[model samples]
Target: MTHQQILDKLSSKYLVKSIDEDVARLTYYAMCFEKDHNSQFEYIFPKLMLRWNCVLNADKNTVTDHYRLITILALCIHLHKYGFADKDLTAEALKAIDKLNEAVVLSDDFFRKSEEIKKIISSLPVPLKRKPSIPENITFYREKDVVSIQLGNRFYAAYIHRLTGVNESPVIEFYNGVFDKVPTIQELEKLNAKGRVYNDGTERISHFSVSGMKFLPDLANQIKLISACVEQKPPHQHLEKSVGLYIVMDIFKLQDEIKSIFKT
Candidate 1:
């Protein structure tokens, strides 16, 4: 089921007649936990998983919605894997790719003398998986390939079109590197500095929260971008708007959490 379908069912079954939050919450609980023990992030997990498995289990092109859904989810998973997780998955995957033989031997680990990079990488996230090549004039159409790079890793991939010639690593590598180099949150606050993350710290969108510092809009924008790029065709207007609205709704719920956190 698409998120809209789930929401529609939710409204009909619970929202219209009763104020009980349990039904909606319980359904989510069942969808994730009661059904799948592998499901992580109790209570605070992104509900995308609920609709995702539903779509995946459906048959055929009929599951078009689910394919699009997985595309975005994969990207988000990629982001988490890259950022809060590990930076090496994409790199290792790229290394095994045949076309990438021209990879420059940039900064080879001098383990013959000093630090061992492999051990460090093993402790990080797994490598990025290679994108399967799509045949030209194909039966199964590939979405226009846009680059999904490890921004922190410094190398960026030319996603859609096969760039005939290029020299660089994925951007995620660099992005990850730069962020690691940035001052810690406490240090930034002490310096009275602002972040360039969303904007110059002035354009605060209404957003939801998880931890005390990170807000839901952070996740929302990531979802929005991933959704747009995931489709076999361009994303529909409603798809984009739906993501935005969902984000707004998250913030509404998030507001109370913030209040409780600050309460005496």
Candidate 2:
């Protein structure tokens, strides 16, 4: 039987918690028991029935002897639960204890091997971490109500406005824009003429559609920048203290406005 199977059998009888339920406490107890199962009275007792205390003069040896008797009773209960009326419960439980001891040894060896392998891998020279090709900074160009975000030398127009009205999901559009100049009608016509095989043998550069995921991090960074700018109020000596306080309060609201868009 597996360690868990044996644990289940024992737990059902003694009513003590298993390693899975309380890993730290049970592991400590198991390690203590492995060292000298007879000497550990504090852990041997069923937690439901007996409580451990920090008393120096307590007869721990006697407690352990009593706990051993209770363990035998647990084995009998385990056997009875499995419909083994005539089985030698004491002998069977001793065998199970031997199996658990063997399992603990195997577990310890596996852990030791794992640690050695980790050390060996750690000693080997690792490859240098590569930097992302995309730049972190996103430049914003605001021309009236339209806001264009520049990413990787390419501009993308993004607008934030409610589609329906109050309590409705806002419409956020991020489409392609001109490289540096404001998109002219002639430039748009040039863009439309991409991938055309003319008799003069001229092909315009392919208009690559930008993926939303690529600009998402840059968009988040823009929101954070807005929030930071709002937080850092400009110093003014001419203003009254109360007026300055009110201005600070309004600036906090603006910061919230920046963050509120990302709440969903």
lDDT of 2 by residue, 1-264 (tens): 222333343333213221122223332333444444333323322321111211111246523433443344343333222222223434444444445445553244433443332232223222112211322222232111223332222333333322222322223222223345234333332222112123454432221112111222221121111111112112222322221111111111222322322221
Taking the tens digit of each residue's C-alpha lDDT, what string does model 1 give over 1-264?
Answer: 222322232223322111112123323333444433223223323333332233334346444532333233232333233222223433432332212223321222221211222233234444223322211111111223222211121211111211111311111100111122222322222221111123232322122211111111122111111221322322122211121211212312333322332221
Give model 2's TM-score versus the native structure.
0.16
| Model 2 ranges off by over 4 Å | 1-145, 163-169, 174-176, 181-264
TM-score of each: 0.19, 0.16
| Top-lDDT structure, candidate number | 2
TM for candidate 1 is 0.19
Candidate 2, residue 56: CA error in Å?
A: 63
